[model samples]
Target: MSNKVTKFFGSPWGQRVSLLIIVILVMILFQPKFFSLDNVSSILLAIAIYGIMVCGMLFVVIIGGIDLSIASAAALGGSILSIFAKGSGYTVEGFITGFVVAIVVAILVGLIHGVMCTIFGLPAFVVTLATQYVLLGAVLVVTNGAYIYHSDFGVFYMLGNARPLGIPLPIIIFLIYTAISAFVLGCTTYGRSLYCIGGNPVASGLVGIKTKINTIIAYIFCSVSAFFGGMILVSMNMMAGAATASNAIGSVLTAIIVGGINLAGGEGGIPGAIFGALLVGIINNALILLGVPSDYQKFVQGVIIIGAIALNVYTSRRSENMKTPLKPSKKTLDSAQSAKL
Candidate 1:
């Protein structure tokens, strides 16, 4: 029984599961209300937006890239949708038009990142960081540096706020989005190729994996996911502005890191990313429930991030060490020599 317990906890999935269980037990002991249906729903609702973004970000991260511009990209998406929809009196046609336009722009931005990274050999961090400014500037320009407040509460409002069968729309969207992402990553040839490319792009291309094109597609998907989440966010708030999802970069990246997805790339999955998002959400919720001051919350979060990163590195090293073969025993070596004689 002890051996079985140790074996279970040694596996990567088992470790994560154990960590989750421990967190839940702590929450139950300290704040029993954490299990209340309303609080659980609230936590899910809050994490759903970032969870959606994490799905898209997983693709790029798998291929060993980062998209620092996602927050700005989301802001741009919301700003575009609100501007066009408001200009058209909140008509259905206007909403569709804005949605389509926002998607197209997102695709273009993603394509730009892909080209600059794959063709020009620029680092994704540099490209995305520069474009982050460009996207934020575009948001400011499009929204005229003012917050867009939606008063009509039409289809646009329902897109984010509506509850179906007692489930929030964002949660449903998140689940569906995660399902699709997981299927593609876990089942498809393209997904497998992404792992290969992330691990060793030169070898992947030598094997006719079309690494550049695949990377480009991954970037596009990431941008579109960010846009989709941004639209939902603005609808929920009934407002859009340059500040929309401003803190998302940190939240999304942090979730990815905490979930055991290596920032260096070629190692992670949808389940881990989602678990990370959920864990972060629960921790933040716990902070609120515990009445931790807002100022202290940020400090606590920073410390948590550092601790999580250290733990991640330690676990990775341990796993790698376990893979190393032991030296041959002296008796086995002597027997082999006697057999040869």
Candidate 2:
């Protein structure tokens, strides 16, 4: 029983459980009425969209890769979908086409990043930074710096706005994605290879792991998740623009870091990312409810991210320095007795 208790509280899930308690306490203290079912449902709904991206980003980060292009890719996806839907008059087929095209475009962007990094030997940071600019420019060019609004797409709006079986569709989708990601990352051989690659790419290659393929797949997953997140944003707002959802990249990074994922990679999991998103979302909502200025919010987020990163580094170093005492062997004991004699 004692061992089980220690393990439970020592795990990532335990930390998240503590965070949830803190969140609840803060919410109750600041706004006692925030405990209503409606607000709780709304919070869950909001988490659904960002949570999906968080899961994918966790995977990418675990592989020692990063994707700053996520926000722009999301904007691009939303903008393209809105524009195409507006031009095509909001038919079911048009919606399908637009959605498919957006996802495909995002995946291609991921492919570009992966191929460039692998083929040209560029750093993931530099590659993703350049891709971010390109994606932003593409969104601006495609949308012509305009917002596309299509109110006639009742189906899309409903998917975003309505709850079925007492649960939001976005939440349901996020849950499904989370389940699949957990399965892939935790239970599959490929997932284990990803961790090995992140730990030591050269060593993993020497050991016959296809490091390149796994890295590419990780980026692909990141892009796909961002694309879906963008779709959700568009559906929720019934509009899309180049500047819409600009704050997500930083927010997502902050969440991932806070969720206990190491920036250097090879650690953290989907559950950590989920909890990080939840904590971030709850904090943001609380700030808004308290009427804090937008600038201050950004400042707080920056501070939180920096602090989390610092903590992660410190903890990692400490863990590395920790040494387990070795048991004495019979040969060593005999040698010690002979020295005493």
Candidate 3:
């Protein structure tokens, strides 16, 4: 029994699950209201927006790439949508036009990211970081450095806040988005290629995988997801600005890391990512419930990010150490000796 217990905790999934249970237990003991229906809904709502972005970012991360521009990209999406809707007096026709244009813009941004990374051979980090500034600049220009508020409660508002059967629309959208991402990554050939390309792009290319196209698709998907989430977010707040979803990139990446997805890429899954998001949300909520100052909360988040990365590195090294080189079978060795004789 002791050995079994030890083994369970020794596995990666087991360790993560244990940590989640421990965190939840701590929250319940210290803050009984943590599980209140309203509080739980609030936590889910917060998780939903970032969770959608996490799904998109997972694709790039799985392919050994990163996008630091998620927040800026989201801001651009929301700002564009708000501009169109507001410009047209918030009618259904205006909202649809804005939605389509925002999505197209997202696709274009993603295409640029993909081309730069794959064809131009730029580092994902540098490319995304640079584009992040460019995107924010675009947002500023469009909004004239002002927040665009949703003047009327219409389709735009319903997109984010509508409750169907007592569940928030954003939450529903998040779950659906996650499910689709999981399906693509787990069930499709394209998804399998992502892992291969992430693990070894050259090798994947040699094996007939269209590495460049697949990578481009992944980046495009990431941008589209970011935009979709951003739109929902702006709708919920009834406003859009450069600061909208400003912390999204950090939150999404942190969730990905805490879920044990390697930054080096080629090793991660939907369940782990979701678990990481849930844990982070819970921690943030706990800090608030405990009356931790905003500055301290940021400090804690930073520490968590650093600690999670360190833990990932440590575990990766440990796993590598556990691998034993293959040895020749006894029959093969005997045959060699016989042949020598």
Instruction: Determine the backbone clash count of candidate 1.
Output: 0
lDDT of 2 by residue, 1-341 (tens): 99998777655567567767887898899897677887777778778888988888888899888988888988998888887777778877777888999989988988888887777879988998998889999999999988887677466676577778977888889899999999999999998888898898899999999888888888888988998898888888888888766878877998898888877888888878888999888877777777887657678789989977776567555544553235565577899999999
Ranking by lDDT: 3, 1, 2
- Model 3, residue 327: displacement in angstroms? 9.3
In candidate 3, what are the lDDT values of residues 1-341, reduced to their tens digit?
99999889878888888888998999999999999999999899889988989999999999999999999999999999999898999899999999999999999999999999999999999999999999999999999999987768888889988999989999999999999999999999999999999999999999999999999999999999999989999999999999999878778887898899988999999998998889888887888999997557667778888997887678766765665346565577899999999
Q: What is the lDDT of candidate 3?
A: 0.91
CA-only RMSD, every prediction = 4.9, 5.3, 4.8
Count of residue pairs whose backbone atoms collide, per candidate: 0, 0, 0
Give model 1's TM-score versus the native structure: 0.90
Model 1, residue 138: distance off in Å is 1.2
- Please list the C-alpha lDDT of all candidates, in the order they appear: 0.90, 0.83, 0.91
- The deviation in Å at residue 320 for candidate 1 is 4.9
Q: Of the pair 1 and 2, which is ahead by lDDT?
A: 1
Native-to-model Cα distance after best TM-score fit, residue 166 in candidate 2, in Å:
2.2
List the candidate numbers ranked by TM-score, top first: 3, 1, 2
Candidate 1: where are CA atoms >4 Å away? 293-298, 319-341
